[model samples]
Target: MTYYWFAQSVGVLAFMVGITMFFNRSDRRFKQQLSAYSAIIGVHFLMMGAAPAGMSALLNSLRTLISLRTRNHWIMVIFIVLTLVLGLSRAHHWVELLPVGATVVSTWALFRTSGLTTRCIMWCSTCCWVFHNIWLGSIGGSLIEGSFLIMNGFNIIRFRRLQLRGIDPFEVEKKIVKKMEENQAAE
Candidate 1:
């Protein structure tokens, strides 16, 4: 019981991190934070004895980090294959495959897409995770993914609004960089 509580505590922490991650308007910052959140959630699942979900989350952490550096389709394929092999090997039930599926979708989105498309794809992944968490009786996990669905939905709408205004959603990152450079130059 104590062990389970500890796992739940970690899930709560992950919930906070995930909420912050999805709230970011900058793609780069979102990916950066998401990498950390994946690792934390991986630990939470592992401690809960869900090996497949834990493995998928850990792989997702590395995959997200790598995605920040390149959007190469080949690299994405490698991650997908690795996730399937690792996740399926430990999966004992259909519910266990949910995390694997979520990770695969995320791998494709992060490596082959950007901005609004990426978030939209991730919304599907989040749904998979929410179902998996609920099936596994992970209180923290369910809350985290549920919150993620709502937060991610808001971000998608925000991105769409930016698009409707004739502004590229990713342009926000460029504007931040430009302002930072200007400040440095002024100094």
Candidate 2:
């Protein structure tokens, strides 16, 4: 029963994101932001498809593993080993880390974005992830995503305001200048 409701909410959020992305398609700045946020939501889709309830437990275990200074590949190898061994042995502990791995991969990718536009969508991504995870009854580590989501929302809203108020454009040469530069360098 709970799973159904949770899935429904996630579906709605996904829909919201999709609609926003579509309407935003003509806007390049928003597209970049959407790309960044989409990465995070994409991870949520992975988690919701995987272990929706175990997100926190999985992330906690990941945090511990990451804290141990283990190399990423080795850590992944060990994780796989545990999954095959301990997991098959009925040790449920390591099996739950799947969602955490998804979250980490998603969040890490989102962190690579720059610019105010991207900074804004970053929050939406985290919120979308946490919103689903929270419904699954795990609050742990979600705040990290949620906090960034709020900050990003604020930044995005500010941008909308600036744009509406006719913000000044940063000057940069277009194709004509670039072509001249190329011709000069050729000479």
Candidate 3:
């Protein structure tokens, strides 16, 4: 009983970190935070005895971190293959595939998309996680996934609004780059 509560406590921490991830307008920061959240949730799932979900989450953490360095097609393919083999090997039921599916979709999004498109793809992943958490009886995980659905949807709309307004959602990055260039010229 105490072990169960401890695992739930870790999930609550993941919930907090995961919620903050959606608030990041910068893709790099979002991915960084997502990697951390995935690691935490991976541990949480493992402690709860959801082996497939736990392994998927841990793999996702590493995948997200590597994506920060490169989006090479081969790297993405390797991760996908690895995720499938490992996740499927541990899956005991059809429902166990939910987290594996979620991880696969997320891996694609992180490697092949960015900003608004990435968020849109992740919306699907979030849905899979919601069902997976419910099936696993993880109250904290379910709540976080549900929150991700709503918050991620709102962020997608926000990005679309910026586009409609003829404003780049990533304009801040451009400004930072220009400022750094100016400083270099001054030096």
Candidate 4:
């Protein structure tokens, strides 16, 4: 097989992992898994000679890791600056900017926001990635992003339904806290 085919096949595997993780209910778990698998996707982008996409994915991994550790906006600002610098440095075509814009949206969503806002921003990012994938001829990658968008929309609808019933869709995190309290009481 050709090199592009091999590299895209690997990218497809990473895309599947990343998409699965993206759907995780736990925010921390989702970010951790996304960071890990996205590194592989970045390498795949590099192998495919899509430098802008590769850099964006790498920076996205870094952003996820940092956001996981803390919610400090300063750190996020620094990363945004870095992303802008790097993106502008190598960006020759307008299409190359697509991944960079997606990264920016994702960084803000993961770091500076929460609740429905985060989910909304993620959907926007998914749209950008879909465009990027199509530009790069990554059929699997585009489909993965499309799937992510649909799943996110479904989850949002489910959350809205829970709200209509006076339930917080985010109660899972609270459940975790409650379980910890129960364990403490037992001890």
Candidate 5:
């Protein structure tokens, strides 16, 4: 097999794990798991010589991990700025901006939103990633992004149903916040 096929094979495995963790819809663990797997995906992209996708994935992995710890938007803002600056530093075609766009949207969704809102924004980001993957000739990446789009759509619909039934699909976040407050007060 060619080098491209070999790199993409491993990339696909990482993408599967990352995407699966993404849709868990449970708690911060989702992002944490995604962060780990995404680093591997980044390496895969690097092996394929897709610098734009590789850097974006690596940055996104960092973004998810940082977002999990703090709600501060400064980190995301810095990340976005770095994305624009460093991302453009290399001689790249405009098509390379696809990953940057997806990362920006995903940063906002993961850091600034919750529940249904997060899922909605993530769907949009996933669409961008799908296009990026296709453009990069990553067959596995495209397939995983397509599956993520479908799965995220289902989740949004499910969350909406829960909302209609008077349930907060993001109750976990609220609980976490409450617990944090309690801990801070005790301290």
Candidate 6:
């Protein structure tokens, strides 16, 4: 791959890293890293002479990683399979899915719990990404996705803190305040 391709791949990888930091909500290190990564991605996205397909792959991967319901295995499976089927394209459009297969399934695997449901899906995605990458003879997207697994692992750690403290991580600040007020009035 060219320098431009590496930069573009890493640049797209950076946006998802930023998402991991935001979700962590309490880790300064993660926040800084995420910011740095996001900036890199932005720079690459703006400056790199990359194919539009690569950019699309990055955006699509971001959607899968950030979208909550994608925590499910079935979606990951379907997406992976769709990516695989698209690989039949002789025009190399299939290569575009490289980043997406890695990032999406990897992110999903990281966020989901250890239950059979989550396990089944992550494993499935892994399989799909592996099979498809081999078919395309590229590792760029898988490498991108692997980074998400690491970043997302940190995100899961941060989420565990909220879980232990008995707060819904997704509950907004005002909702928490309302709950507190209701409790005080009840008392």
Give lDDT per model, in order.
Answer: 0.87, 0.42, 0.88, 0.78, 0.77, 0.45
Q: Best by lDDT, which number? A: 3
Q: Residue by residue across 1-187, what tens digits does model 4's lDDT show?
A: 9998998887888877777764566776877887987787888888888888888889988888877766666888887888888887888889889888888878878876665567778888888888888888876677677788888888777777777899876677546545554664676
lDDT of 1: 0.87
Q: Which lDDT value does model 4 have at 131? A: 84
- lDDT for model 3 comes to 0.88
lDDT of 3 by residue, 1-187 (tens): 5999999999999998888788888877988999998999999999999999999999999999998766677899998998899999999989999999989989998877777888999999999999999989897899899999999999899889989999889777446545544664676
Question: Model 6, which residues run further than 4 Å from truth?
Answer: 1-82, 88-147, 173-187
* Pairs in steric clash, model 1: none
Off by over 4 Å in 1: 172-187
TM-score of model 2 relative to the true fold? 0.30
RMSD, one per candidate, in order: 5.4, 13.8, 4.7, 4.9, 2.5, 9.5
Better of 3 and 5 by lDDT: 3
TM-score of each: 0.89, 0.30, 0.90, 0.86, 0.88, 0.36
**Candidate 6 lDDT over residue span 1-187, tens digit each:** 8876676566456545544443444222332453455344534533443233334344344434333322344555555555444433323455445444544554455344332233344435545544443454333434434545554555556666666889755446335435544664676
**Per TM-score, what order, best first?**
3, 1, 5, 4, 6, 2
lDDT of 1 by residue, 109-157 (tens): 8876667788899999999999999998888789989999998998899
Per-residue error for 103 in candidate 1, Å, reads 0.6
Off by over 4 Å in 2: 1-113, 166-187
Ranking by lDDT: 3, 1, 4, 5, 6, 2
Cα error, residue 57 of model 3, in Å, equals 0.3
Over 4 Å off in model 5, which ranges? 178-187
Candidate that would win on TM-score: 3
N/CA/C clash count, model 1: 0
